[model samples]
Target: MFLILFFFTGFTIIAFISFLDDIYSLPSRYRLIFQFCGILLLLCQVYYSSPYSYWLFFFLSILSVGIVNAYNFMDGINGITGIYSLILIICLSYVNNFITTFIEEDFIITIILSVSVFLFFNFRKKAICFGGDVGSVGIAFLLVFFTGQLINTTYDWKYLFFFSIYGLDTIYTILFRLSKKQNIFEAHKLHFFQILVYQTGFSHLQVAAGYAISQLLLNIWIINYSASNPLFYLPILFLLVIMHFIRKKQGLAITIK
Candidate 1:
């Protein structure tokens, strides 16, 4: 009961501030500060419940913050946020039902339903609305909380594969920006999905559906075969190489322009 309260309270703080940012254009620093505070509150519940090592706590804190920001950064197009989040949440729901049962089934269902509603409006060729920072950040925080709990319960880090797609895109974009001497913190449309939409002439729905499908396939593999082999990351590595080639080809095109 207390854990649920902690989770919701922390989520409320992050979501409320994110909502404000959507409306008021709050400074980045203030958003970051509150984000950390919110994550800290969620982690506090974990700390008191199981008392893991300080190192683990520190790592989870950093990871949680990164994921929250990554999720927010990835929310740049129609249907991508709603679609990707719905797929990921559905994957988590599978884990809850068949794997480890860390969170409530009803809780996951409610989220699925909410994302479905958002998709009805946002998944069209001309989106009626967007997830915005509040929607993206809120769902990201909730997933982080759920993922953290599952990892804690099972003591398996492989579950992180659930976030592989977004994590890959975020890391690659940051590195690509750094190589060009650009500030990664600034807003730009360098993400692979963005590139597909703006540069490759793909429709927003097409790009969004591509991402969701890729993640769905990846999640299926992770849930089935990853536990048996250590080389599960080979596919992820292959994906990285593909992304590199695409970006390289596109990077040259941008240069020629």
Candidate 2:
């Protein structure tokens, strides 16, 4: 009961502040400070965990806060963030049972699933709140912590591959932008999803589906690879080509030098 109360309090406070920030156009630095504070409070809630768990959640808290911002920066279109969160939550629920964690497994899944449903409505066409820094960061923080718990229990680093799609997009987009001497932080349409949205003439739903589908396919492959021949995992390029083909058909692929 206390633990649920702890998470609910933390989530409510963060969401409310984030809602305010979205409407009032809060300053970035202020958002960062709030993110840090939120992360701190969240850490305090789980401080009673073991030394290793404590350290893991601590690392995850900091990183989750950053990822919250990362996802926030990238979420310019409709349905994207909600879809992304949904995918992560579903995957976590499916994967968590396989790995043991001190955190109540079903509770984490229930909370996130509930959050995603509510956020979906809030984010659809008319966003009540833009997920602001709070929503993005909180989701990121929680997901990463969940991932950490899984990693700690399973001890299988291959699970990291599940997040490879996001890492690829975010890292590649940043480097690609930086190479052109552009401000990587500034809003730009260089992201593959953005390209599909603007260049390919894909609807927001289509573009969001593309990303979710690609990642889902990769995760499916991960599940299969774990059971059968690891050798089948080769030819990632083939999969990339298919991904590009589908995105291009929708109108988003650009010729890269």
Candidate 3:
């Protein structure tokens, strides 16, 4: 409980600072510095003696920072971060139920519900506020922590595959941009979600709703499959393709943006 509180405090601090930074127009370099500090602090608290070695721990620390930033990048539209956060939390919840080891359901459930409440307000049209970079970093930190714990105990390397949607989209989009000689890290409205909103004229809420529902259904199917099955994953790919077309027809493909 104390450590969970620490997570909230750390992220909330980041979010608060980000709020100021957003309003005051702080230097991008300063904000990056703060984000790196927060990540280092969070990493310091995470010690793993479970099943992995120092090398894995070191790798995860670096990966968590990258993921934290990647999520911040994806925060180009409303509901994207919150929706993704909620999906991951729910996935962790289901993961808690089926897996015998490293149960942290209470903390994970609390975080999910808390974020869901936050999303209800933020994911709306003409939102009160965008979830600034701090919101992005904070949630990413939480997910990384949980993910590490899950992989540590379950020893399931394939669990990472569950993040395929976000993983593939962000990575591919970056590569595509780079191939075209574009700055991969810079802010641009080229992501799938952004394209969907701008080109399709789809209501922001509707697009977010689509992603949320799709993620919900996908996670449900994965949970039903009981980690033993690899074959079920193929069908998920088909669904991904179908969803892409639906968005494309609706003028929502991320690539089009």
Candidate 4:
């Protein structure tokens, strides 16, 4: 119906405009405009007939847009996007099968097959083709939709842990940059994965594999223990501690004299 059409059409527009930007180096503001237009169209088509649902969708619209961009921001390293995306998609597919079927399982399988092929090209010493904005943002939008549907169906907020791996890195990186008085919008090699590969001398595959492994572990934990308690944030704290020590071990953190 209208929902499917709007979703695909918006995704197409954003992917197309972002692909152009990848080629021609379009201004950031113009690219944002296209992203907002696409996201807005998708949001408006949701079932928001009631006032509560309308406001809920409105809130989701803003959050989804940020997540879409965050996925793009994390796409800098080779293999990182394809690998992390594969992990998330696989976990979500599991959730669909065993826990709750918010989305079509076949659709999830299709995504898995596609990302597996992408990893063959991307998870290598030399990438054959970069995902470009189209690949990253497009996949981001798709993940957000699946995650949102799961939340809507279950009414459990803890399911947001599905994004814990990327969420931690993105949120912490933004705060870290703000504390350093850097322009958050401008691109830089500040993300944790970027630091691991660029500064620590880890190969792209190593760092990417490390992230995917860690996420796989976390997903296993989330699946075993329901994260309904407030203590669910404990796992994220452990991850932060691990990242801190990793930076220290790699000589990337500044030591006070």
The numbered model that scores best in TM-score is 1
What TM-score does model 1 achieve against the real structure? Answer: 0.94
Ranked candidates, highest TM-score first: 1, 4, 3, 2
Clashing pairs in 2: 68-136, 68-137, 196-252, 200-251, 200-252
In model 4, the runs with Cα more than 4 Å from the true position are 44-55, 247-257
What tens digits encode model 1's per-residue C-alpha lDDT throughout 1-257?
87768877898999999999999989989998999889989988756667578898888888999999999999988899889989989999999999888878998999999999999999999898887899999999988887887877887777888888899999998887887778777778888888888877899999899989999988888877756597777778988998889888776334211
Question: What clash pairs does model 1 have?
Answer: none
Query: Cα lDDT of all candidates, in order?
Result: 0.86, 0.64, 0.68, 0.80
Sequence-dependent TM-score of model 4: 0.89
TM-score of 2: 0.70
Per residue, candidate 4 scores C-alpha lDDT tens digits across 144-164 of 767867777676666667777
Q: What does each candidate score in C-alpha RMSD?
A: 1.9, 5.1, 4.1, 3.0
Give me the runs in candidate 3 sitting further than 4 Å from their true place. Answer: 1-47, 101-103, 224-257
Superposed by TM-score, candidate 1 places the C-alpha of residue 123 at a distance from the truth, in angstroms, of 0.3
| Candidate 1: worst-modelled 10 consecutive residues by lDDT | 248-257
Residue 106 in model 4: lDDT:
91
Query: What is the lDDT for 240 in model 2?
Result: 53
Tell me, by lDDT, which candidate is best: 1
